[model samples]
Target: MIRYAPWKVASIILGTLVAILLVIPSLLPVSTRESLARAAPWLPARAIVLGLDLQGGAHVLLEVDTPSVVRSRVEALRDDVRRALREDQVKLTGGIGLQAKGVQLRIPDPADRAKALPKLRQLAQPLGASLTGAVSDFTVNEGDDGVVQLMLTDAGIDARVRRAVDQSIEVLRRRVDALGTTEPNIQREGNDRILVEVPGLQDAQRLKDILGTTAKLEFRLVGDSGANPGDVEQLPYYKASEGSGTLPVEKRVMVQGEDLTDAQPGFDSRTSEPVVNFRFNLRGGQQFGQVTAENVGKPFAIVLDEKIVSAPRILGPITGGSGQISGNFTVQGANDLAVLLRAGALPAKLTIVEERTVGPGLGEDSINAGKRAAYVAAILVLGYMLLTYGVFGVFADIALGVHILLIFAFMVLLGATLTLPGIAGIVFTIGVAVDANVLIYERIREEAHSGRSILQSLDTGFKRAFATIIDSNVTMFVAAAILYLFGSGPVRGFAVSLGLGILTSVVTAVTMTRMMIALWYRWKRPTVLPI
Candidate 1:
């Protein structure tokens, strides 16, 4: 135990050197690191990412619009019911009746009701698989007088809201990523809300705009003079610089924005105006071609969020699956629209219920405070070990320094975000790091006083304390893992630092310190052990 092979000694030296090199870029100034990166592109230039709390950014809490989600689901169910009845040749006495939670219709013939019952029941999809069983999204109820009601269950609504939140998170993530920010935290807060944290982004309003836009695009035919009143509805038409007015449009959607595969900002060749160009998938392309081919010389409306952006007549069949939208958009407006289209529409509307912006000044103050606390902690730990253990204390202090370097190196490589709580975790671990050394040193003192030789005492002391060290560190590591798994934001940051510190501390406190002592003993051949 007192001796190490030459390869082992060489490995220790090489590892420490590599860790120092990895941590050096983080310690350097941003400008210096950038210069170094430009000069030597092969070198690693990554530094530890600072969390929102330490870097100042936007914090937005958005709640999914439950009413909108329910309304959408009901409308979709109405469409499905209509399609089912038409396809099955089961005639209804009246139009599909819209309800707050679902739809209803009347089938006068008992045979038609019997035929429609199974068809409508087929529309009820299984929500998802679970331990107990799968539940249907909606229930089909048949009442007397041939009246049938389709009601959405509460569990179904809850499940839809949950799914909307999940999809919204992904959409928001894509939108935020387009801004070129680093390490944004986008996660679900609860069943119906999402919490977004963007580090180093001070433009809260822009973030809100990007997140709030539903970007629901649709294409439908303009209502002709002879069209039925119930088949058409008046929607607001948005004309640039001309004020908004109403235009009658058909209710049937020809194509939806979900079929769009890509969107880009470009200029209109004829008018030299900014526009958004979009390409649709094969299914949408086929539908679009068929509609345009049959509707030549008729007007079609391009709608976004129920507002008409443009109403242009179908000149001919556009078989290429690509089209452009012109609405007198500015360059920035065109770009923003393209981004939204590329990110895809949110499953439901999201309202920003809470917003806060952290200023850089406050972030700077936090960073300084954390540095002071860490410096004080290092000084106290180093001074205490020196005063208590003399020359051996110096060895422990060196190991402690190496442990810190290893922690920073690991964080840099992993790209972990450092928060104020993370700094506190590092300080707390600094004190905990030397506990193993304390245990070993005290054990050595006991053995030497019991009349064992200095070499025998050192060997027995390390072996005896090693198990206790592993047991305690393992417990702490498990606790850190639990915290990381269940906690969010700052708590997670603290857990990361604590978990990493535990790993490095074990190496430094046990392996590195023992190696130093072994080298010292072999070289000096000391008569008495230093206490």
Candidate 2:
């Protein structure tokens, strides 16, 4: 082990020099770091980011209403069936609406029953291609009362929920990234919950505001039955006018936010006020044009999250696919709306069920405590090694320091987050790193006592101890890998630090320490070992 080739020696020296170079930027100021990055694009410019527990920030637990998404799909299906039956001129009786776990519609007339059954089955969307044919999302069945039932299949519901969760995660990532918080951690906690941690965030409330808003936008025509108490479909909206009791709007949507292609915060040229300007896709633009052209004198409500934000009259056709939404909005509000529109609406609403804030002062205290612990541990370990092994102990201590430097170098290169537990990992690593050196030195002492020369003792010690070191560090590495794969948040940080420490410890302890001892041995030509 002590006999290294010329190329191996050069490589080790080069690697150590590279580690020092890469780790230097992390310790420097931001300006110097940026300058170094500009000068050398190959170097890792960014420092290790602190975690939420270490840097202090907003921690939020949001529960997504996944059931509500399923319910809304059922409701939409009911509406579509009603519209389809009516448009096909099929006579329908009894209520056509959502039932326990499916949609139910009655065709009392025997003649129309057969006709309606075919039409209802036609509305069934194929789940995917199959050997027999397309698999439908719903199973159709007829009852003795001439009622047709469309029950949603279990596979359908499962697929819907899975898709909703996936889309929600993607949208949440986009929203958090839009906020420009540094190294924000957004991940799904369970089937219906998301955990968000934004480190170094000062305005947690603002983040809450952004996340809370569902930002669902739609356009519906203003209803005619304004004051009628007997209207079932016409619900009253207070924001339509001041003290107007209520301004009814249609239940059907003319344009959904899914059709929106772009949205930006800009000033309306005519009003010279902040507004959210939006554009739609080709199909949406055509539909919007036809609606506006047909109802030139009619007013339509622009609804956002169940509230009528604005009701504007159709003055002309908008064939350009672009329009402006002017409301009682500040510049910031308009910008926020634009951002929401651009990110697309969430699959389901998210309720902030739990929230907490960790202050920077607490993080500083944690960091200070961790540093003190590390310092004390390092001092005791260094003192013990020196007292036990003399000059050889100093070589081990130097190797230990290099082992730490390499860990930080890897952390920066890997963009690892540092937490309090990560500090614990490092301190634990300090002890473990020295343990390998201790094993080798003790083996050398044994070999020297057995009438072997110093060179023979050193070679035999490192060679025989190699297998034991490999076994111990390999086991540690496997445990850390498992932890990292299965664990979350702070546990992951610990795994990362611990894993990196294992690798660096192995490298520095085996190669660098032996190299240093070999140089010392050659220079002194010692007849007896240092210990």
Candidate 3:
């Protein structure tokens, strides 16, 4: 165990030096690190990322709007029902009646009801594949007097809610990423809630505004003065200066925002006002061109989140697939809208249930407390090792220092976030870093007392204690892995640090300490063991 090769010794020394260098940037002041980065861009300037608890930022808990989800699903079901009846040539006594859960319609003729029943049943698609079986999204039921009702199933609503939460998470992630914050924590909390944590961001309100806006954009024709009341609805005009009242717009959508391929913020050429320029996909472009060609000289409304943003008359067919949106917008407002359009709309509205801004002052206090705890841990551990074993203890103390350095170096390389619990994990690892060394030293002492020679005792001690060290570290590593896989937030941070510390401690305590002892023995040819 004490034997070493020339390359092995050189490699060990080189690795120690590299680890020290990797940790140096993290130890430096922020100003110094920035200056170094500017002076020499090739140097490793990346440091450990601090978690929200350590570097204080925004914490927001948002809940998906259930009612909005249900309403949208019902409206979509109504459209599907209308299309199915028109395709089957079935006559209805009244329009498809909208309900909170689903839609209903009455087929006055018994023959038409028989024909429509089969067609409407086909509209109830399977929600998703499940272990139990394929579950339909809607149930078609026959009522009295040739009336039929299509109701959304409970499982279907849950499935839709789950999908909305998943899509909203991705959309919110994209929007948050555009803000250029580092290491933002965006994840689902419960079935309906999403928790977002952005470290080092001070603009809590801006984050909320960007996240809360549904940004559902649609294009539809402005209803004619004599249009049927049922075909048009009064949507509030978004422009306050023009009028605070409503504009009558057709219920049919000409184009949807989902078809947008790109959106950017720019200034209007004629008015020099801030605006959002958007381009559509191939299908959307064709639909837009067809609509513009059919509705020339007619006004169309640009609607956003159920409100009319603008109503402009179509001059001619626009086949270029690109258009601009002009509203009473400042530069920032235009940019925000462009961001939302590019990110895509949320599946449903999200209401903020909880919001908090963590100031940097509390983070500073936490960092200071962590630092003090770490310092005290190192001092106590080093002092204990020194007093326990004479010269051999010094080697163990040096290895412990190297272990700490390796932990931080690994974290920096992996871009791990450090939290308060992570600091506690580090301190705890300091106390255990010398466990292997202690075992070896104690075994060596027993061998020496049994009248064994110094070299024989050292070799026998390490070889005998090696298996125990590995066994203990392996169990701890498994525990850390489990904690990391199942835990969230601060628990995850602690797991990361603890896991890294375990691996590093094994390397330093076993290999490096043995190497130091071997070199010391060769140089001094000690007649008696230190312990």
Candidate 4:
């Protein structure tokens, strides 16, 4: 279709531009990433929303255990009540029961209620715990028979939920930041659930795994599982792990998951088997050596959640401030376990309530939409140019083509994500770009009609049009900069397009298009311009 095409040099340039567009973004090197960010100071390097699927990151939904929070508060209140009663020397009988929303306590006599009233106020002062719907001014309204009662005021279950939510926000913030990921998206989805999204993550499961580990490191004696209470006492610590699981007498562990500074997977020196080796720092090291020294030759089990992963027989005192957990493991499996242990365990458990993976179908759909939009815009721009300038419209189209090709190369070179929105921006640029060339062409036409040589007309057109083109493009560039500065997600994408459009349009209209005109003039210096 392209007969008597431009010089081999021009074709090479065009081909290189196309190749860059087609290849670069997909294979963006780390160095190029930084350079692009540096080059386009307007297009921010940060503040872009990198989806989980595009970046291979993790996402998590955390549901706060509100019931536990409520109960814990109630129990603390009960403790305060008991302490206040003791302080006031009130004869308190029985204990306290937590009902659906309120608490009921058993007391001896109505007279005792009066005696306990002052102490109750003192204790309730700190509770800040309020009553449900009823205003708990807790008036000590004594009946005709001198009967008194404790009542509640404003605050209730809702208040507790609010406090819990606030605390949860703080804790979750700490947890996510501890992970060392880039600005993670942690937002409250509803009242109880928190949604977290992380980009450039290696493992999504790591989120659950880290959040799940209770991190409760405890050490108890692992005695014979089959032993009776007396037998457990007689059999010592090592025998407990021998029988366990279903009805076996479980032994308590003496040491726990804590007290470890570093852990890693390594081959056992004596036997070429995989094992997790861990070492303790200053304080833990001293404690570990003391424990082992006091109980030399005694078998201790390495238990995880009541199940024994391994229990190597103790031979002499391990005074080296380090230990190994040997098991039958492949190299990769061992390494993964080591990494998990090193990061420490999670505080609360997490469940995967929802999952949506953006597969290739979505990617393809985006690509199709983007291409369609671009095609439509390109067609309209070409048609308008053809109508406005007639024959020279073809030249503008060629220049427009080169402009687009260069933009793609620029996107690839800069590692700008070719998002569907990004595609829309690129397509939109095509239409806006022709305005620059239109100005120059219109100027040239006016010059040619005024009885000037074609050469003089061309010179006047470019020289006069350059100022107007620069002025208009500078405003657009400023607008794009502001949009990018404040916009997020898709809005940011539009800004990126607008900003980049100004630069490429100037280049294609001024330099590339001028080169084309120069070649055309050299080949045939027509007396009158083609237009």
TM-score of each: 0.95, 0.86, 0.94, 0.53
Model 3 Cα shift for residue 339 (angstroms) = 1.3
Error of 3 at 313 (Å): 3.9
Where does the lowest 10-residue lDDT sum fall in candidate 2?
A: 231-240
How much is 15 displaced in model 4, in angstroms?
11
Q: Model 1 clash pairs?
A: none
- CA lDDT scores, all candidates in order: 0.92, 0.85, 0.91, 0.63
Question: Which portions of model 3 miss their true places by more than 4 Å?
Answer: 29-31, 108-110, 240-243
Task: Show the colliding residue pairs in model 3.
Answer: none
Model 1: lDDT equals 0.92
Report model 3's TM-score to 2 decimal places.
Answer: 0.94
Q: Which lDDT tens digits does candidate 1 get at residues 82-195? A: 999999899888889999999999999998888889989998998897576886799999888899999999888988999999999999999999878999999988799999
How does model 3 fare in lDDT? 0.91
Candidate 2 residue pairs that clash: none
Give the backbone clash total of model 2. Answer: 0
- As a whole number from 0 to 100, the lDDT of residue 231 in candidate 2 is 38
Error of 3 at 301 (Å): 2.5
Winner by lDDT between candidate 4 and candidate 3: 3
Candidates by lDDT, descending order? 1, 3, 2, 4
Q: Candidate 2, residue 461: CA error in Å? A: 2.3
After superposition, candidate 4 runs with Cα above 4 Å error: 1-336, 339-354, 383-395, 446-457, 467-498
Better of 1 and 3 by TM-score: 1
Writing each residue's lDDT as its tens digit, candidate 4 over 73-172 gives 5656666667776776666445655544335565567767777877676544433533433323222333444333343333544455555555555545
